[model samples]
Target chain A: MRRVAITGAGTINPLGHSVQATQQAMRDGVCGIGELDIRDVERLSIRLGGQVKGYDPDSRFNRQQLALFDRFTQFTLVAAEEAIAQSGLDFDGGLAAESGVVLGTSGGGLNTQDENYRAVYEEGKNRVHPFIVPKLMNNAAASHVSMRFNLKGPSFTVATACASSNHAMGQAFWLIRGGAAKVIVTGGSESMLCFGGVKAWEGLRVMSKDACRPFSANRNGMVQGEGAGVFVFEDYDHAKARSANILAEVVGFSMTSDAADIVMPSQDGAARAISGALKDAGINAEQVGYINAHGTGTAANDKTECAAVSNVFGHHANEVLISSTKSMHGHLIGGTGAVELLACLMALKDGVIAPTIGYQEPDPECALDVVPNEAREASVAYVLSNAFAFGGLNAVLALKKA
Target chain B: MSENVKDRVIQIIAEQAVLEPADVSMDQSLSDLGVDSMGLVEAIFAIEESFDITVPFNANEPEKSDFDISSVASVVAAVEQFVAEKSA
Candidate 1:
C-alpha cells in the first residue's frame, strides 16, 4: 500500500478564517464560541454558538457563484481554495483526472432550506428559488470543489453526522493509499446555526445555553458550531516527487459503528476505532503522545470517550496529553472532525497541544490528563483525532510527523 | 390527574425501553428495563412533551439532578408531582 501525505491544510472555522489564524488561536487557547448572531436568534433558548464571525459572502463570491453556493458550500470552497493554493498544485492535465474531492456535511444548503422553508411556510410564499435543490444537495460542496479544481476522480460526500469529516478523510486517505487517486481534496463544512437548525437541536436538550466545557465536572452540554476545514491528501511518492511541502503524514484511519443506540456513544465502539487506528498505523499505544478528543461537552460523550481512551491505552492514557479543541471551537457537528484535525496537525507538525478550554472543574469519570485551560508545548510524533457522532458512528484518524 | 400522569410516564418509559406497557414494572429501574442513556434522554423528552412539564434531569450527572429516574415508580412519581404543581 502507498503512503498518504497531507500536503496542504486550510480552514475557515470559528477560531479563524485561515489555517495560520486558526493555528495561532489554538496556540493561544482562544474561545471562538460566543453569542450567535444569526436569523431568529431570539427564538433560540440556546443563544451561544461558534458561528464564523465577520464573514461577508458577497465580498468573496461573484453573483452567479453566490446564487449556487450555500453557506456550507461557500465555506468549503474558501477552505479548498486555500488548501489547493498552499499545495501549489495546478490541476490542468492528467493530474486533474487523477485527483478528486470528497467532503462531509450533515446539512447541505441548510441556509437555503431554512430560508425557503420560511418563505413558503411562514410567509405563505407561492414559490421558492429554482436553484434550491442544486444549492442544498449533500454532495454540493464536493461537486463544487471537484469542478473548481478540475478533479474528476472518485468525488463524493460523506454524511455520518458528527463523524462525517473523519469518515470522509478516512476514505480520501484510503483512496490514495490504495492507488485509486493520486490526490484528493477532503474535509467537511457545516452552517447549521440558522433558526430552524438551532430549533431542531434545542429539541434534543443536549445543547448548552452558555458554553461547551468538555470534561469539566460542571459542564452542561455542547454548543453548536459552524465552518469548514479542508486538506489536500496526496500520495506520498507523488507529493515527494513534486517536492511538495508536506504538512503531515496521514498514517492510518479507522471507523466503527456502535450499532447500539441512535444518540448515545459506546465506549467499546470508540475504543475499537482508537485501537484500530493505532494498529492500522502499526504504532503501539505508548507511542502516541497526543489525542484530539471528540470531547463534546455533553456528559455522556466526555465520560464515554475518556473511558474508551482508558480502555485502549491503560496506564499510558494518563500519560498522554489529550485535549478537545471543540471546547475552543464549539461542536461543528458534521464539520467538527475536520476542524478538530487541525489540533492533531498542530500536535504532529508544530509540537503544540491545543488546550481544552473552559475546564472549570475535574470529573473523576474523566480522569485522563486533559491539557486543560491553556495550550501546552509538547513534542509529539504520533497523534490521533477522534470523532464519535450521533447514531453511534465513530471515526478516528491517526497522524504522524512529517 | 396524578394517576393519569403516572400512566403516561410509564408508557413513555416503556416505549423507550421497547417493552410492552403490560410488561413494564413500576418497581423496575430504567436500566433493568434496558433503557440506556440515549433511551433515558428520549424517555425524558417524551415525558416532557406528554405532560408539558420539564423534567430537570441532567444526563451528565443524573444523581445531582433534581429529577429522580432510578425506577419507573420514581419517574412516574416525579412527573405526577410536576403535573400537579403546574396545574395548581
Candidate 2:
C-alpha cells in the first residue's frame, strides 16, 4: 500500500495568519481569544471569541472575486494558496487531472447567508446579491480550490460539524494511499463569528463569555473562532520524487459515530475511535508521544475526552503529552481539526508540544497529564489529533515524524 | 403561582420528557423526569412561548440562572414570575 505525506501545511487562524506565526504563538502559549469586536457585540451574551484580527479581503482579492467569494471561501483560498505554494508542485497535465480538493465547513458562507437574511428580514429588502447561492453553498470552498489549482480528480466538502476537517483530511490521506489520487488539497475553513452565527450558537448555550480553558475544572465553555487551515496530502513516493519538504507522515485515521446522542459525546464511541487510529497505524499506545485533544473547554467534552484517553492508554495516559490548542485559538468548529492537525505536525516535525493554554484548576475527573499552560520540549515520534463533534461524530488522525 | 400556569408548565415538562402530565410530579426534578440538557432547553423554549416570558436561564451555568430548574414546581413559579413581570 502507498503511504501519504503531508508536504505542505498552511493556516490563517485567530492565533496568526501563517503556519509559522501560529506555531510560534502556540509555542509561546498565546491566548488568541479576547473581547470580540464583531458587528453586533452588544447583542451577544458571549462577548469573547478568537476572531481573526488584521485581515482585509479587499487587499487580498479583486473586486470581482470578492463579489463571488464568501468569508469562508476567501479564508480557504488564502490558506490553499499558502499550502500549494509551499508544496512547490505545479498542477499541470497528469498532476492537474489527478490532484483533488476536499474541504470541511459547517457554516459554509454563513456570513453571506447572515447578511442576506438580515437584508430580507431586518432591512425589509426584496433584493439580495446575485452570487448568493454560489457563494453560500457548502462546496463553494472546495470547488474554488479545485478551480484555482486545476485539481480535477475527486473534489468535495465534508460537513460533520467539528469532525468535518479531520474527516476531510482523512479522506485525502486515504485517496493517496488507495491510488485514487497523487495529491489532495484537504483541510477546513470557517467564518461564523458574525452576529447570526454567534447568535445561533448562543441558543445552544455552549458558549463561553470569558475564555476557553479546556481540561480546566473551572472552564466554562467553548469560545467561537474563525479561520482556515489547509494542507497538501501527497503520495510519499510522489513527494520524495520531487524532493518535496515532508512536514509529517499521515500514518492512520479512524472515524466513529455514537449513534446514541445528538449533542453529548459518548465515551465508548470516542475510545473506539482513538484506539482504532492506533490500531490503524499498527503502533502501540506507548509510541504515541503527544495528542492534540478535541478539548473544547466545555465541562462535558473535557471530562468525556479525558475518560476516553484514560480508557485507551490505560497507565500510559499520564505519560504521553496531551494538549488542546483550542484553548489558544478557540473552537473553529468545522475547521478545528485541520488547525489542530498542525499541532500534530509540530509535535512530529519540531519536537515542541503545543500547550493547552488557559488551564486553571484541574478536575480530578479529568486527571490526565494535560501538558497544562506551557509548551513542552519533547522529542516525539507518533502523534494523534482528535476531533469529536457535537453530533457524536468522532475522527482521529495519527501522524508520524517524516 | 396560577393553577393554569402550573398545569401548563408541568405539561410542557412532561411532553419534553416524553411522559404524560399525570405521570409528572411537582417534586420531581427535570433530571428525574429524564429530561436531558437539550430537552430542558426545548422545554424552556416551550415555557417561554406558552407564558410569553423570557427565561433568564443560561445553559452554561444553570444554577446561576435566576429561573430555577431544580424542580417542576420551581420552574412553574419562575415562569409565573416572568409572565407577571412582562405583563406589569
Please give, for residues A1-402, the per-residue lDDT of candidate 2 as tens digits. Answer: 899999988899999999999999999999999998988789877788999999999999999999999999999998999998999988988898779999999999999999999999999999998999999999999999998989999999999999999999999988999999999999999999999999888778778877899988888789989999999999999999989999999999999999998899999999999999999999989999999999998878989999999999999998988899999999999999998888888888889999988888979988988889999999999999999988899999999999
- The DockQ values of the predictions, listed in order, are 0.37, 0.52
Error of 1 at A302 (Å): 2.0
> How much is B81 displaced in model 1, in angstroms?
5.2
TM-scores for the candidates: 0.93, 0.96
Off by over 4 Å in 2: B1-4, B20-23, B51-53, B80-88
Looking at model 2, give its docking quality level.
medium
Q: What is the lDDT of residue B63 in candidate 2?
A: 71
Residue B26 displacement (Å), model 1: 6.2
Residue pairs with clashing backbones, model 1: none
Model 1 per-residue lDDT tens digits across residues B12-60: 9889888888899989999999988778878888887887887776565
Q: How well is candidate 2 docked (DockQ)?
A: 0.52
Screening candidate 2 with a backbone cut-off below 3 angstroms (N, C-alpha, C), the clashing residue pairs are none
Error of 2 at A255 (Å): 0.9
